[model samples]
Target: MSLRPLTKFGYLGRTYKFFNGETLYPFGYGLNYTRFKYSMVSSSHALQLKFGRLQHCRDLTYEDGTARPPRPTVVVDDITCGKELDFEVDIQVQNVGNVDGADIVIIYSKPLVGIKETHIKQVFGFQRVFLKAGENKTLKFTFIACKSLMVVDKTVYKVLPSMENMIVIGDEELFLPVQINIASCQN
Candidate 1:
């Protein structure tokens, strides 16, 4: 009796779609051989700073040299929105002695105070970096916020009933938050 079926594999269909140009996707794409490292050089306090430490997920554990979930991660240093803050992030990327590689750096922000949930605001920028074998690259960033734009209270930005008295005295306090993301070729 024949142990194999007569049906073709799914790979064939995917391959055709990739090369046909009829589809928007490319075949054998998204494959990489090199790796990348990321490091912050500095940022402008006028830009608003945001960053965090890298850590593994708690739900994942290794018993006998096994892998786990929630791999390498970048945590955000929560900051109050609308408030001005000055900080810097330094990062370095070294080729793991394999081959050439690249990386993409992303930064984000959120509202710190008077927000029900911490929602992602906007993307700072995308940095495309390349590295050579055994070579390391560094990056620095500075961040800041505009008070006029960040103050969520209508009184601070405009005029509110409750803020009338405070407006007369002066401007109130506000805080703005920012986030960071680092992705390597390996990930």
Candidate 2:
């Protein structure tokens, strides 16, 4: 039998996707020859922002961990949408290893409010950087709501009045939701 069939997860198999119900460690999680430390250099406070009504032409379908069927994820078009509510965050990465090495810095985030029960943190940004044995660098990451947060249809953006009015950044979860009172998306 294949490794998938030998494990106890059935067809789901033993993979990073099903790390929760099982006791297996997360992928890439183990002792490394070199150690990397992460710290919060700075982050913007969350705020409550308002947006116009969001319009969806068709229902998108795809594999979503939260939903047995599927869920909505932003595409490239809406991901590029810009607004004043967007913010930036800085993270300090230090290579505490005896030898030089490179590491990829990943940025994860979640809405103070859940996005259709997709509560797990989703990646928004990442950058590959190299460092010396004792080198430390500050990386800048932009918190684009359209890309990382928020839901949209075909055009325009929408905000849920009942949703949590705060944006939570990973690491410290600097929650400061910007409430946006959207009238409607009529066009």
Candidate 3:
């Protein structure tokens, strides 16, 4: 599968509607024999200030003991920029069906800045949870506002402050709004 954002498909994404038009299935598409319901318990609509960019990211190790670069890491202290904004959302998923099944929860992000030549939306996080019939679970996700910073022309990387960052769940069926305010650092 193409890990590049859905919008990168160009005509395939627009004309074929691979990610735009009406389709039978879309990215991260899956089906389960049971029904599931999702509810927002708490969501952060504002960003919290932090000191710097992410540092000391450990390589992700698989079950086979292989390591992968770009391991997930938390933001750390740096002085090049002002406080970094952090956002998070908590969601509750319940299996209301009669039999046990698994459901995959996908998280997508859209930056509302005027950045040109970027994906319509990008998938930031996802997880699969299995639950018994009528079981429910709570999942929490933390994303850095700077994580969505875009690199254009393979040389310039820019962070757009005051950009409306939206956290969408499950095909836009649900979403939480968060704003990144780092106007002091913007040029």
* Root-mean-square deviation of Cα positions for candidate 1 versus the true structure, in angstroms: 20.1
- What are the per-model numbers of colliding residue pairs? 26, 17, 0
Q: Give the per-residue lDDT of model 2 (tens digit) for 61-162.
A: 222343432222333353235665467767788899998888776565444322332223445577877899999998887765555555432233342221
Task: Give per-residue CA lDDT, model 1, range 66-148, as digits (tens).
Answer: 44333222112223443333444455556665887765544443322222111213333335567777788765544443321
Q: TM-score for each prediction?
A: 0.34, 0.55, 0.65
Name the candidate that leads on TM-score: 3
Write down the lDDT of every candidate, Cα atoms only. 0.32, 0.49, 0.57
Q: For candidate 3, lDDT tens digit of each residue in 32-119? A: 8998888887764775443334332221122233333322322223223334445567889999999999999988876443333334
What's the TM for model 2?
0.55
Ranking by lDDT: 3, 2, 1
Off by over 4 Å in 3: 1-22, 48-84, 113-115, 148-158
Top lDDT: which candidate number? 3
Q: Give the least accurate 10-residue stretch of model 2, judged by summed lDDT.
A: 55-64
Better of 2 and 3 by TM-score: 3
